[model samples]
Target: MKDTLKYMGVVVVFLLSLASCTKKWEDHFGSTSAQKTLYELISENSDFSTFTDLLNKSGYAESLKASKNYTLIIPTNEAMAAAKADYDFTDTAVVKSFVGYHIINSIYNVNTGVDTVKALNMRNKYVEFTHGEFDGVVPTQSNLIASNGIYHVVGQPLKPLQNIFNLLKSKFFSTKQVEAIASFDTVHLDGETITYHTSPIWISEVRRNMTTESRKYTYFVVDDESYEAEYAKLKPYYTTAYEEGNTTRPDSTTTFFTKKAVLRDFMVEGDLSPETLAAGVVSITGTAFQLDPADIISRTKTSNGAVYRVKHLTYKLSDQIKQIKVLGIDPRGYKQNDKRGNIFFRDKRDMNGALYQDIEIYDHKVTSFYAKYRALSMTVGKYKVYGRAIMGLAGDPQTAVFTQYVHFFDPSIVAVNEPDLYKRPVFNYLGNADTRMAFEVQPLNPNEVYLGEVTQDVYGNMQLLVMCNGTGPIILEYLRFVPIIQ
Candidate 1:
């Protein structure tokens, strides 16, 4: 009995020593386990099986296995299954774009101690990490670290951000709306027909603001019903040059201008809250208007901004086409009675950040000298004529003040061509000469000097005459005709 007890004690000691030796061996070799790359971790996890398959299809799964530092965002199998409808995996380019948006080149983990970090992904798009979220997506499993970098498992896949133009195309498909938006492209017509989009007139409004992902905007788009309603509302004001000869009524430029007019003020800067929409008059233009909350059907968050699809959009004709401005440099009938070297076109930048091509007629010290501009698109309504006359050219100290009055005449009835103002070739004076219409031109830029109002009995293009009354240099920027909204 004593011999058996001693033998049992020896066996227990030997087993304990073997367990100790095994623990030490594991400690020495475990660094290889820590050397597992993010790709290795992701590929091994059953929850990320779908993501692994997508990464392999993207042809970039091998990149994640490299030694470079990165931050990968992986979605669960369920999340990937849900995202299948949103993407076309059949296209290689689409798969690559989707995968590239997820892998950031830099390392970012929760332990970095920052609540929000705006990191640039492999696709050069900004993916914002705010507390527990990534690009508006919250992580289901936060910050799992591996050898190459850290990864977060999200319930939803990160979608690449889309600018305003792409958002409009993807969300809305109305007929007139689509036609108007697409008309800005180059049209190959073999003739003397003039294309209105030769110069990008909407650089400030659409071209620069809408196409860039750097700037944020809230685009309000209407459905077909809403577009048709808005189009009909502005039909009376936006008339075509050649009528169908059916009615003296409005033929809205439904092909292009009308849709542009309707959607022009729809883009507002920054994301607006529901509170702002509830206040009404969202300040779409300078006019006070109202928006019914019930009219908004859906709102989608975009990469650059948000897109709100509404059922109704209110646009007042007066606000939409508030004024028709005839600039001196605008290629119209800027022709004078005499063609000489005295007429100089000067480009000046206004303090209001507007570019002005001013017309400065020098060496013409004679009174009654005038410059005629073809004022187009004048409807039959009273317009408050205003002129902005900058007296001096940019970088020139000659700020001489000049006095001028405008004369409106029908081009069909203009008597004759006068070579000179002092010595008449052949001419006739207009009748709407009021004292209030005269402008005392000064150096103040962007100030709209009101020059009385004119009532147009005919609805078509008319000739507007800017006649000089003083001897100083006649430096004028633009002539504007603002419709009396009432």
Candidate 2:
């Protein structure tokens, strides 16, 4: 009878211990009695009937129920109705993608004091979450803890916008512009065809930023009227090539090159607000333009970038030339030991508010460094090529002197070896206390280098080489080509 009493006591203790563990777990992870799986919660709630229907149609209800830990964001029935007015939810692929974008792969509790967080959704895109907004949609009911994960009821359905190309095609651009943008080349691979777009303007960059890159971009689009006005101003120049029998298309010149330049000048690299843009609009093309806050017609935010529509915009040729960095040139490419055993080294140094790669020549021998510049027009007239050169004091009495041989090559790829274009001196380097000196090279008699009437055969390209044989180290900062106003 004592043994039986002891067994009963042991059984009581075991039951009490098991109950204590269950209570502790419930306290730590929240009450499971009230908590239900996301699928069950959605199924049972009348408010989430629309969302439940969508999940069922998308075949995600079973998946959500089986998932261990996830955060599910569902829009209320009203939000779904509103979204259905704009979007076609009947498409299974669209529904699946839309639904997947709301289900975060990890648990995110909104009440945990996270003011802002980027949650990765099942679609692999990040859904930005704030206290009141989830992926730009306001949440009606938030932070509902479930058995497997959390749930947030949003008032607006989340839908990824069309890519930059399609977005511009539908609303912003004209039919001609859309056709040009839609132009693509097809390549066959593994018995399948793939389309590669040929739009060379900001579209490709914007598309890449939106799809592949993590970086953000701010795109400024000129209205159709403004674009047409700008094109009108450039039409004469573009038609000249066709009139002269150089190109087939009426505006091929502008359509191929100048138009792209105009578009590129409006795009900035980062997410810049209107106030920041109003201060000064600096473009990816290295040109700056002013923006009035009142001039912005509309602003739209996309997944990876933002777009602003402006009433009108203009860029100055002088501004473009001044702001343009030297093209097709690298200081590293000049670093080599030449045939005469002269060593050239290059390093980036700050010069006159700008960073320039200074190429230094160690030995006093004729070491040649060449660079090519393209897109020069006959209408621009002659240009004065100016550059900064420095001679460091070395050996003997610390006086350095050097001669720079400058030669310009026309499109024939033959160097123009005229005396007026070559054998420029560095006698100015003799007396200056500052080792770095700014200099300009022009025609000895004329005000500037006269590039004769350019033609198609000429192609308006200039390849120049500066060969220097100096007494000491010679540093060349940059070569600037400034158009001389005729």
Candidate 3:
């Protein structure tokens, strides 16, 4: 009887021990876990030297210790390096502001196997720190797990919500004002009134073409009566900028805003321009031409009346689209006979060079699979300039000079009237690796791209003549630059 009793006692004790272990694990990451003092967490994590110093300097230590309902997204040292790729990371004020915003004064643990935090109304209460989204929040480097807190990895120092706009303006883009004479807000180009927020690619293009004088003061509708009054008030903002000496300089920020906010008041207000009003004030810069003072692209009507969004500040658009287009050239083309004046295509079976051979609409689903190399080029007659080819390679003529090449990513090519043509059928010349000269004499040279007018010929055959100067053979890849249609 005594032996039986002893065995039963052993089993009960073992069960109790297992329960305790499970409970301890759950409690480690419970809602109360983040209540530990900051000094205690920092003392254990000596590697957080820069972060700790900032916390101390900002006098955030006492505040953090006193708080119970907060979540802190701490970053490691490596995260700091990744964020400040171009700028020096040693700035004390910048680093402090960055880390400060990452910490929320709420007692929440993301590591807990639970959906949704009471703080973020995010689906399932989970906060995401991804790029191209979530402007106010950021992700940090290294996900740190502690008895009371969680840490995330970041590449750059954190910036507070207040400084977020300024930081982005300084690095990625800034705003600018664009002024033009008035006209109707709508136009049927190929079709469609492409107002509202255009793709970033198109915005970049407008920035490139704008001049200094036009960018300083942006024109918007204040009704026909207010045009003169508003223009006079806004004229002072247009003074010629200077750098060091007396040389007049261009303002970059003003030019960027002119494109980003395609319709001056699109986001802030809805469509403002209605035909009911006879004559009204409008910002210019017409279609097809960069300098013409034309019509307003977008307008909104509010209780205050009609207000148009004009490009006032400036920002340079990205040239990445040109780069992406080069990468999209069909590698399968290299396998075809492409002997002379051969039509290129995306699929080996299709050779008509269908309008969208290598290019595709910016649908995330389709493009993810179809795109290739990031850019493309060839060494035709020695000169190497980047191709700003038109959509569909519309114009190709036998007599046309070698001024452009087809960009693979976007359905476009850059061609100009080339002065020279070495052969009649536009015979193929493969990039360096193909040496047998199997492909037609491709025009673009490696490492260089052209920035001049690129037009097509009547024949629909691609042709370009360039002054190429680069060491390597030209390459081709996929990239797209959506034009800003206003």
What is the TM-score of candidate 1? Answer: 0.62
Write model 1 residue lDDT over 261-342, tens digit each, in one string. 5666677777676568867554334454556898888888776678787767666666665667888765344445564577
- Model 1 lowest lDDT segment of ten: 419-428
Worst 10 residues of 2 by lDDT: 443-452
Task: Compose the digit string of candidate 3's lDDT tens values, residues 403-482.
Answer: 22332211232344212121112212222321011212233222223322221111111222111112111222332322
Alpha-carbon deviation at 115 in model 1, angstroms: 8.9
On residues 101-171, what C-alpha lDDT tens digit does candidate 2 reach at each position?
78888798664345657677877666777755776677777777777888888888787654444466666
Candidate order, TM-score descending: 2, 1, 3
- Report lDDT (Cα) of residue 258, candidate 1: 52
Please report the candidate that would top lDDT against the real structure.
1
Best by the TM-score measure: 2
Q: Residue 184's C-alpha lDDT in candidate 1?
A: 54
Alpha-carbon error at 179 in model 1, in Å? 6.9
Q: Each model's TM-score?
A: 0.62, 0.66, 0.28
